[model samples]
Target chain A: MPDSFDNVSVSTKANVYFDGKVVSHSLILADGRKKSLGVIFPGEYHFGTADPEVMEITAGACEVVIDGTTETRAVAAGSSFTVAANSGFTIRVTDSPCEYICSFGTP
Target chain B: MPDSFDNVSVSTKANVYFDGKVVSHSLILADGRKKSLGVIFPGEYHFGTADPEVMEITAGACEVVIDGTTETRAVAAGSSFTVAANSGFTIRVTDSPCEYICSFGTP
Candidate 1:
């Protein structure tokens, strides 16, 4: 059996990475402005729930705020969070850059 | 205000394209085989609902099979379909290659 999925094609895709306090390869809009970029903070902060769910992952160690609640979750490399569609939250990173994949559906 | 959203990052992403009857830049698994590959037929086929939703799009003009029901929907380039999480079904493309994005979460 094939190891990966086949019979699919994607066009115009990009990769991005984030370093604590810095963002790179962020998605740009028609006006050439960064769109839906992720930020890595030195520590976790309070992020209230909002529309367009927010997904977060900690490349290093960090904490997260979900739906007005606070939790100290141990986020490791490659770990991912699927923020409910149209949900709100906040995240704080410690020790290293909080890396993750933030994508949007076709508008 | 920025035209697009901001404060997000993505690492290691890819795009694929379809040309009515061929698949390219498909996602590979550890086994080096095509897993869950999409096929483009001359016309639309029936696809039942299954786990791990399947997303489909039409690069050219075609039809689709959703949740065991056959529906002739107009699919255009750049349009995308988000198959419900863990759904199963079949799709038959007509006139052109039925293009779409098939991505899997980290295992």
Candidate 2:
């Protein structure tokens, strides 16, 4: 099958965070849906979301500690996890850089 | 220092090519510029551009034969090359997957 969202346009600015350990490109679609495609270098980070998000691991693996959870979950490439709107999560990249696509949805 | 264009927004749509060997996310910045962040698997491919493009190798390496040259040049991670508008080029990825950001410019 073809890749997802192959028909949309992209912006020129990049969304960078955590002292450049996390870098992403922001996207605005024709229908107004927003998303970010980025790569995270090996590190630990905590993030909060305003909208519900579907975080897909496009490449590499990482461990996540989502809200209400004390244990960490292993997330590998080709796998995905969702976070509720207004909630938060912690991600730890143990090895290689992790590539991801964060798709935002209505809360 | 910091990564380039690290504050722009991206589109929700993805730009897939060569039957998934090349996959990218499109971005449309607030300033109206366009770019695509994607990865290219190990393979040879031919491409043509409608606008001048700066192909930056963010991770990994690849070889490129731009319009005027028949000799392929090595492009490792942290390096880049340029192609003029309406021109075409051929790229060969001899080893690992090549991660790139193709930035478009005025003709």
User: Per-prediction TM-score of chain B?
Assistant: 0.46, 0.89
Q: Assign candidate 1 its CAPRI class.
A: incorrect
Point to the candidate with the largest DockQ. Answer: 2
Task: Tell me the lDDT of model 1 at A31.
Answer: 41
Model 2 stretches astray by more than 4 angstroms: A1-4, B1-106
lDDT of 2 by residue, A1-107 (tens): 11345434454434557745676666555677776777777889999988999898887899999988898899998888899999999999978678788889962
Error of 2 at A77 (Å): 0.7
* Model 2 chain A poorest ten-residue lDDT run: A1-10
- Tell me, by TM-score, which candidate is best: 2
Residue B55 of model 2 has an lDDT of 91
Residue-wise C-alpha lDDT for candidate 1, range B1-107, written one tens digit per residue = 11221222222322212221222233443444221323343654544444344354524445455564567556665564545545555555556344444444422
Off by over 4 Å in 1: A1-25, A28-39, A47-51, A54-58, A105-107, B1-107
